[model samples]
Target: RRSKDIRFAFDRVFNEDATQEQVFAGTTKHLITSVLNGYNTTVFAYGATGCGKTHTISGTPDDPGIIFLTMRELFERIQATEEEMSTDLSISYLEVYNESICDLLLEDGGRGRSLALREDQNGVVVAGLSEHHPKTVREVMQLLLLGNKNRAMSPTCANAVSSRSHAVLQVNVRRRPRTASISSNVTVATMSIIDLAGSERASVTKNTGGRLLEG
Candidate 1:
């Protein structure tokens, strides 16, 4: 027999004992500051089926997750600087399934018209997608709950409740000096938190037809 060695490097690695807070602080906490400084940021998880992608992105109520933690810190910072900076926060959630985009924030469970992607000055964006202004972290979490309820899910041999799509939560932040003149420039940025669908192999997941195609 012949043996070969392969090595890979990463910025950081976490073990099963690592708490959600530790993971968030080490990996994603810095992005919140960037968003406030008018820089776009995104955090996403990708891996094979049943690898804890969803659990890391959206944890249980008792033990919250990255989304909740990020929102809490964002709101706290906004409140602390309310007198110096007037800020606005808006959020939109959507999913990509089977190469199709659906607005998860839609009242009709994202089954209405199809959404298209277009590029603007900022970057690529979903055209005609709905956006909601949330005043507090609780409100933003409510919106998240609603969107998750509408996300696509299916059963597979690898995992019982497998996510069938990529779920993206977009938070738009706009800020201006509270005492600035009307002509003063306003800083705007977007933070995207995405939970990607897990990869699957037909032999392992036992998927067929549509599910297989999604994988």
Candidate 2:
């Protein structure tokens, strides 16, 4: 019998020893800074079930994750320039399930009202989605928690709390240089962070009934 070998290549790879700070420094820090400078950006995580998509995007509170870290930096930058710049920050979260779109930030008691996706000069946009402007990190985090509680999830043999839908969190930032000369000039940018549901094989997940349908 002969053994087959596999090989793969990527721009960069991190092992178990890679700290969350290190990962963010290498991957997300630039994007966060760019958003402040008026560049639209998006960061999305994709992988198979039981991989580390959620862990990397929304890790434990103590460990933090890309979302928390990026938001913190944004607030910090705003504060640093608050004396000379006026900044507006807002957030919106939503999920796509069963080929239908649902707004997570809606206070609709988890009834999962289907929203419509529209495309404009901004590419794709969700019509009638709730966008929250948070003054502090605590407020933004609270909104995130509320939205996450509405995400579609189910248990499977591959992993517990397996996501059944794709979730997106978008942060909108508008900055105005507050000088007496050009107080009306504003620069706007957006950052969309998405956490996609992992794909699962029926045989591997061994899901049944609703779980099977969800997977």
Candidate 3:
């Protein structure tokens, strides 16, 4: 479902099936423009376990999954727009483990309390969490792998190394309009790559070891 306030996207305009290259090119172009104009955006992924969340977010860099594609598109587009405008992009990646938030790249560093569920003034979830800043896509990707390595997992009759935590990879794009003729407010856009924990139960998983340790 689309948010009532957000009315811009590449897939909606380009129609991915129509032309992948042009679509990719166009989306990157919009992202660059949005960043310069002070508009924040987020590309988030959500779904049940084993639904290709990891495959989508952290796929091989060469093969290029969504995150990689977006990063490449962003930098490439920014480079392309260097003649006209300038922009800045920052990234942060973290994992929610047993309701606790931790830095994916740091050595097991986290907060005092676990993630708490809360609502903002608008009654929307502001959720409990702390975030870290990542400078490069390589840093973000490395932290993702680190988090995956640390992710709670277990063996069942079905599969091995099942993800036991929810991971959130966030990208914050900051853009300042060059001229006052247009809206000059600094705008930020976000892209969130979320990998959720598995839905299987303890009984179903018959978990032990790291899983039991998580238990």
Candidate 4:
């Protein structure tokens, strides 16, 4: 008997032993630089329940994930060029639950009403979504923790706290050069970090009836 072997091509690959920093350096490091220069970027996670999406994107405080690492790098870069540029940063967090969009960072504490989607020349955006301008890493962490607490969740057979909704964290960074010129263009860019709900089979999650539909 003979066996066939196959080869695959990829921009980058990581092994189990790879650290969180290594992953960020290889995949997301360049995006930060581009974002600083006025380019929008989005990083999302997708897979089945019990997969490593949560672990990779929002790891524990001790091991920090991409979001926190990215924020740290962004602030560092901003500080490094403070003399040459002025930057403004704002953030908004939203969750899609049962086809409804809810603002996670709403002043009313993720309550009130569901936000509406609107579109114009730029693209589709959540209408009247709450935006928070956080100045420091601590403030950003506070908003992140608040948003996480607001995400829909229910105990499942596969996991204790299974996320029942998709959460998106968006950051808008606007930069302008200090020196004035005839064509001093302003740069506005955005970064969206999404933590998507994982798929769970009815058999695996042991959901049934109305619960099955919800799952």
| Top candidate, metric TM-score | 1
- Compute the lDDT of residue 178 as modeled in candidate 3: 50
- Tens-place lDDT per residue, model 4, 1-215, is 88889888988888999998998898787899889999999988777777877877888889988888888899999999999998999999999877778998765545658889999876888998888889887799899898888887777788787877788989899999888574788898899988888786778888666557665
Q: Give the per-residue Cα lDDT of candidate 3 at 99.
A: 57
lDDT of 2 by residue, 1-215 (tens): 89989889876689989988888887888898889888999988898888989888887789888898888888998999999888999999888877778888877523646888899986778888888899887787788888888888887778887887888899999988777466475778999998998876778888787666655
Q: In candidate 3, what are the lDDT values of residues 1-215, reduced to their tens digit?
A: 97677666544553325433453455443564554455555544455456555665556656546666666667776667666554677665666775577665455544444445577643433253444555556765676677666555555643565667777766666655455346556555666656676665666667776665443
TM-score, per-candidate, Cα-based: 0.95, 0.88, 0.63, 0.89
**TM-score-better candidate, 2 vs 4:** 4
Rank order by TM-score, top first?
A: 1, 4, 2, 3
Where does model 3 exceed 4 Å of error? 1-48, 109-136, 179-183, 208-215
CA error at residue 106 for candidate 3, angstroms? 1.3
Pairs with backbone N, CA or C atoms under 3 Å apart (clashes), candidate 2: none
Pick by lDDT: which candidate is best? 1
lDDT of 4 at 138: 76
- The superposed Cα distance between candidate 2 and the true structure at residue 192, in angstroms, equals 0.9
For candidate 4, the 10 contiguous residues with the lowest summed lDDT are 105-114
When superposed on Cα atoms, how far off is each prediction in RMSD?
1.5, 2.8, 7.8, 3.1
Looking at candidate 1, the ten consecutive residues that score lowest on lDDT are 105-114
Ten-residue region with minimum lDDT total, candidate 2: 105-114
